[model samples]
Target chain A: MDISFTSLLWGFLLIIIPTYFLHHYRTGLVKDTLIAALRMTAQLFLIGFYLKYMFDLNLWWLNVLWVIIMAGVASQTIIKRTNLSLRQMFVPITIALICSVAIIDIYFMGLIVRQDNLFETRYFIPISGMILGNMLSANVIAMNTYYGVLRRERTNYLFRLANGASAHEARSPFMRDALIKSFNPTIASMAVMGLIALPGTMTGQILGGSDPDVAIKYQIMLMISIFASSLISVLLTLALTHHKIFNKYEMPI
Target chain B: MIQFNNTYFIYDEKPLISGFSVNIARGEKVVIYGPSGSGKSTLVHAILGFVQAEQGEIIVNNLPISPDSINEIRQLTSWLPQDISLPYNSVRDMILAPFEFKANHSRKPSDQEILAEFDKLKLEHNLLEKGITEISGGQKQRILLLTTVLLRKPILLLDEPTSALDAQSVDLVINYLKSLTDTTIIAISHDEKFINAFDRKLLIGQF
Candidate 1:
């Protein structure tokens, strides 16, 4: 059932018809979409080559190294996406993502899956990627929401401080707000997951010939992994980076 | 006591207050009068540690204002900024927000006491149950004033507290403030009526 490289090349023809229509309409997104498709194709092929070697080696240290690199990239992406200063944010975010990824991936492998070799590439790499990807989005949302509200309503924050609130007390509401805003989308999507859309990992598992029951179980476990990792990463990043965002007088930076 | 010794403040690289000096003994009610953009608000904020004086020292009760001392200084002063941005929740919540802080947690007022103060300030008791957005700006200002006074801080720094209020409410507030004979009041105000109630008037914008 797998498509060969020749068949995949033919698949490019299917994309060209829509791209032609887009060009005719002067949508101006034709170049961007074509570029994006080309990038995706090239990047996936490169990763495919790298991952083949990675899996063949199956060295625990190498697997851990791969996950660490994934976490580093996720941290950088989160900072870049939020338009925050990377120099101020990247280190804390990397620490947070790495800590969460290591803990969650270990829990998933050892306790949940009960694997004898926890760092086996087949289970570790893809699962770690899922957790890091989800955590990346959550961290972006949390940072943006927290800083946005603080910046916009800075006077309100100071007013609270002037009225006898300690800095921690004053920031409680903003912290709660940011966490809720960050978790809301994930929670809502979880609520309607199967009815609205089959998740990609679950679909991929089924398409790859796994039994439906086994695929569903893995899907549930992965969702929990993603949720826990996201929560841990965001909270840790926020806590570790709080000092950077506020001055000594507790003013919003 | 509050003292500003040759304080210099610059906003956006332009000097707003330069070589400014002032002194007020404890329990004195001083009103700073200035036109818009004259840095009167900035002067008040500097005392509250919201704005820093670029040069010279701002001393309250003989203690200089610094990052380490700002919290303690602020605890002794309640500053009401010109822009009254209250939480859009029940009026009671907005007023009680300060009390929830550990510093003031023990000073949480009874509902009866809060309602009585609201009545005195011309704020309706029903407004306490309503959302803050339902109230007028004057009501919000008075609620903030009420919250400040309830803290019973020794020093009060108010920025145009009566700017949103009517003549009658202004009189009520001025009188209530006047009755606090031992409290130090440093206010920024333009209303002739409110200014007349203060013990001393400092005219800014001379620079």
Candidate 2:
């Protein structure tokens, strides 16, 4: 079912059709597409080798350490995409992601699937990666929306405070705004999941030669895990960091 | 009562107010007037702990405005900032929003009280059911004033409260505010009528 190196190289021939069309139409994207294809191939090849060895070793500490690395990189991505100060957001985002991903991964491995080896690298790493990857988008949306709106409508926040609202009461609307903006896309995706598009995890599982039924079950589990992880991570990060974002007078810092 | 005891405030390393002293007594209506960016609004913000005074102290009702006491002081004072930013909710929700806070939960205004204040401010009772965006600027300004009155705080800091009002509505609002003899009022305004109605007027950017 897998293509060898020669077959994969032969697959490169298919790119000529799109490249010729792009060049003829002056789309200006042929170079970018080719470079992106090259980068993807290189990165995936490197990771394939790395993951093979790591999975072979299958040490618990290694799995945990790898997940921490993933969380760290995810935190960097979240901060960069949200245009927040890295120093201010890094630790909070890292802690939030780690706590959420670990909790969900543990629940999935130990309780839902009840694997004999709960910390098996194959089970923990991919599941944790899936959850972490999904959380990055939600975190970016929530933090960006919350801080962006707060900056734009600072007077609105202060007006609420001037009306005798406590800090929590004053901030509740913005928090609700962030949560709704971030969660709506995921919720919409969930509503149309199997009918409109086959989810990534299910497709990957089927490609890896698992039974279709098993792949469907895994996809549902992974989707739920992603939803739970994203919710917990965004809320926890916001709760932990909101105090630092404002001055004593509840002004945006 | 509010007192600025030799207060000093700096913005971007430039001193805006230094060794400034002013005392507003109970029930006294004081108007602060100055050119824009002359730190008049900063003075009001300083009283609320939004702008830090580099030296000296600002005392609201004899309680210093500091990080620890800001919440308590804010609860005792009602402020109408220059921007009358109202939520997109119905007029009733906007007016009743303050009561939803824990500090003011017990001080919730009755419908009759709201109606009375609305009548005094010349607001139509039917506006309560309309969204805040549906109201005119003058009407919204009056609604904001109505909210301040409903808060029933002992001290009031109003930044250009009548800037958006017409001549008649301005008079109506200023007269209604003047009638609140029990409240200490500190206002920032350029309107001669509003300033003349005050007991004292302090000019910023000079001694």
Candidate 3:
């Protein structure tokens, strides 16, 4: 957590060699590398400043506000991906994002992790960020799959509906396909967990001088919580936002 | 039976079909002919519950149609739109799309039945496994037409089914549609040959 000038200098130096090599390996990666580097530095610096104040206060409302902000940003990103106008999607997107992140944060911090203090910024903030990250990805896939598949296979979906299929039934195959693609990484990572390697969360704990057993226990709990939260968030977003995305007659927005 | 009781539909406040009342009897073959922008496609879509009439009761089989009843009405009709939006699947797969519904899943025709149907359409059995994305428009029309017929619905709404085809395919389609034993046929066409084959025509424009 130290942010000395030496640390900053070393970070820049570390990136120089890798960025230079990437530029050589892929001639087109120069712009992409520069953008990513700039984004990372700006985002991390802002986050560090924000966290310094939030952790200094360590108030529950401040922690919750930050989580909401993150969720709102994630939902906005999802909205930007679709064909629908941004103004039309605000209500549904916000509902899905807030409901998802709040429920996930509560479950992760309150029930599973069981912090000594409910407002512990260290425990709540990092966990909420991780959960939001997973939820963001799942929602994007759900959005892409739900609308993209409808556009691509309009006839099939129409035929199904015309054949007395409800929206849920008509869209089941595409939804299933999209969910599979989105969740494949997490599912695979779970299967290869202990056998392949230690997860980053557990490694972080061990690096910070916690007992291996304690880190292992925390990792198991977090993984389970993440899996459950992700399932509910993805399912809820797909279900709730669908009504708004379609007109009463099931026309695309 | 389908009856439009003074159906008034407007798209973006521009009236498409206003006070349009039309009754299509069961087992009737009716062709809808008009120029572009004549609301032919819109009418067809309204029948299938794809579009909502602004102010009218569309009665089907003696009941005022609600959104809940749309499924039942749709079950009794087959539609082949002017544009085919078949996905990246095989021709055989596309033909079998309708029957994948649970209502029709159990009733998929046997191989012999399918072959017999394909034979009537002059479709080669080898094309069964061919990719749908690779098929010609003519082939797509024929297959889609065949699939609709297989639904065993009493009504058919064809939107320019022959517009993109050669003379032979048009002849085949017109003949097939005309010769069907007992089905209510609604075809939207401007072709002279297609018009000559129809028993009754509703010319939307110049009336």
Candidate 4:
């Protein structure tokens, strides 16, 4: 079912419409768009070859290592996107991502999928990647909102602390704001999922020859896992980094 | 209950308060008055460990203001900062927030007690139900003042507390604060009425 090179080239031709609009509107996005498309194609092809080889080999340790690598990359991306200090944030975020992804992957592959080998390459790698990728966006939004509010409303925090609030109590309001902001979009998307949009994971499975019924069930479980992993990772990252980011006096560093 | 011994504070690489020395006794109401950027606010904040003294030490309730004793010091004091921006929908929520803290759990004021303070501060009973955004600047200031008073802390640090209040409201606050016989009050204010009402006055940045 793979498309031939000629057909793929035809698919690349579809980018011309967007390029024409960019040029006509003087949006200055033509070069950026073309470069991004080229970069995406190159990266996907490289991963495609790597995954093909990995799936054929199907070694447990290799699969675990790959998932760890994905989590590391996702953590680094979250730190960079949030514009937080890498030295302070990288380890905590990486640890949080790895731990949360491992929990969800185990629950999905062991209990639900019931694979003879829990670390089966096909189930382990893709499922972990999906969870990590979804979590990256949520962590970025949550961290940004949390730190932004704390920084902007510093006086409010100090007011609470001076009025006899513990450090945890003072930070509760900011944490509430972050959680609400990060989860609202996901909640809305989940509510209108089937009616408004066919999710990317479900569509990919259906196209890959999975039965529609099976694909739908997988998609449902995936949505739940994404939400769970995101919540756990966001909380973990905040907890792990809290001491580092605050002074002994409970003021933000 | 508060001592500053030759304390120095630096902000932005410049000495803001240099070699300052003061010993405030318990139950004394002291007023600090000076021009803007004179470090008057910073001096009060030093006691809370919000701004550290660059060269000297501050002691509150006989405890040195350090990381180890900061929580203990804060638990004994209530600070109403110059810039008050609370994250609460209604005035009552803001007033009640501090009581929810574990440190202040035992000091939760009764509704009657809160209403009495509200009346003393000239705030109407219905003001508590209004959203914070719906209240005026003066009302917001009084409401914040009421919260600090309700904590019943032994030390009160007020920074320009009456800046937004009218003359009548200012007198109400001054009289209420003056009546606290066992509380040590350290305030920064430019209001002549507020300055005159204090038991003693210290002009900062003069030396």
**Per-candidate DockQ vs. reference:** 0.76, 0.75, 0.41, 0.85
lDDT (C-alpha, whole model) for all candidates: 0.88, 0.88, 0.78, 0.91
**Model 2 regions more than 4 Å off:** A6-37
Q: Which ten contiguous residues of candidate 2 chain A have the minimum total lDDT?
A: A240-249
lDDT of 2 at A199: 92
Error of 3 at A238 (Å): 2.0
Off by over 4 Å in 1: A6-30
Better-scoring candidate (lDDT), 2 or 3: 2
When candidate 2 is compared with the true two-chain complex, its DockQ is 0.75
In model 4 chain B, the worst 10-residue window by lDDT is B198-207
Instruction: Write down the RMSD of all candidates, one decimal each.
Output: 2.4, 2.4, 3.9, 1.9
Highest lDDT: give the candidate number. Answer: 4
Which residue pairs of candidate 1 clash? none
Ten-residue stretch with the least lDDT total in model 1 chain B: B79-88
Best by DockQ: 4
Query: What is the descending DockQ order?
Result: 4, 1, 2, 3
Candidate 3 lDDT by residue in tens digits, B1-207: 889889988877797777888998887888888878878888888888888888988887776667677767877777887776755478777777778777777768766777767777788888777897677778778888888888777888788888888887788887778777688888899888888788888877554
- lDDT tens string, model 2, B62-155? 7988888898888888889988576667888888887888988888998888899989988888888888778898888888888887889988
lDDT for residue A76 in candidate 3, whole number 0-100 = 82
lDDT of 3 by residue, A1-253 (tens): 4458888888787778878888878878878888988898899889979888888899988888888888778778777866555676666776777787677667666777777676689888888787777777777777787678888888767767765566667788878877887788788999999899789999988888899999999899888777777777878777777777777677665
Q: Which prediction has the highest TM-score against the true structure?
A: 4
